[model samples]
Target: MLNRSGNTKYQIKDAQQVYRQLSVSYEKIDSTSKKLVAFADKCPNIDENDISSKARYATLCRNIRMYAVQVLQNFSLSTRRVPTEDEIKQARDAKQRSDNELMEKVILSIPGINGKTLELSEELKPFIQQYYQVLQYMQQAKLAGRDDEVKLLESNLEELAQAMRVAHQN
Candidate 1:
């Protein structure tokens, strides 16, 4: 029984060694990607088979590098640290500025607001006020454990802006 167990342990180690040998290294992948990109750039036209193959190889190399970086990042996630004072301050300042700009844009779109000529309906005033309130809440929420929520809000704001653009165009 002991002999079988010892053999099993050796087999596991050997498998790991083989796996590491086959896996791509970050530097090797980056070098290969650069070479492929150079080749692609030198090609006369993008429709050529050689250029296509080189582009595919370059994309593969980039994926390999990205996988390696993600693995490293996952390893670091286990020992993640809180942001330093400077980082926190910088993030806060950026959030404040972004929120200020967003507020200006939204208000300026309304008639009779921010020197804009479009008159807003009475029904829209409450919604606009609520929007500013939500923005204020998010600005203050940045200091709390709400970074992820703030990011969601920012994404939604982007979608809202796109919708507004479409509405205005129509």
Candidate 2:
């Protein structure tokens, strides 16, 4: 948890851990729901249709509340100081590597849909241009310390590529 109030700052690892916890909770909810449905079906006197939707809703609500509580507890434990300048530098490098991997997959794979040839023609040039725009926005985000904005721009760019492919095909 990165707190705007007080002096708390979260490292990237902390954010990743929170996200992982959320993922695990979602999986747990899915498994529990499946089990409940199976159990309801096994009851001889009860039709699946006779099973109360309210029970399902209540269980989902309880699971969500538990997830929220866990997240809050994690945040309460996340009162560490801001990362040192060196740690920040390392984080930036790691982020750059991750971005490079994603860009290679998402941007470079967009046609004139070549995976790695990197040749540009009239058709492919527009894709490259859009990618450059995304890169520029990402650079600005880095300077402004707005990494999430950069990721949003990347997602938008990826969507634009998909739209372009559809338009070109049509």
Worst 10 residues of 2 by lDDT: 112-121
lDDT digits (tens) for residues 1-170 of candidate 2: 44777677876677667677766775666666556555543555544565586466556656656665676567647745446568889999999787566655655546455556443346755665677677788789989999889889878877877766655465
Best by TM-score: 2
**Candidate 2 global lDDT:** 0.65
Q: Please list the Cα RMSD from the true structure of every candidate, rounded to 1 decimal place.
A: 22.9, 19.6
TM-score for candidate 1, please give it. 0.28
In model 1, pairs of residues that clash are 111-118
Please identify model 2 stretches exceeding 4 Å from their true place.
1-112, 116-119, 167-170
What is each predicted model's overall lDDT from 0 to 1?
0.57, 0.65
List of clashing residue pairs for candidate 2? none
What lDDT score goes with residue 141 in model 1?
Answer: 69
Per-residue lDDT of candidate 1, residues 1-170 (tens digit): 13755653334345555545544353465566566556544555445667667677567656666675676556556633445567768998999788656655666754433325434445444455555665666677687869988887666555554444344444
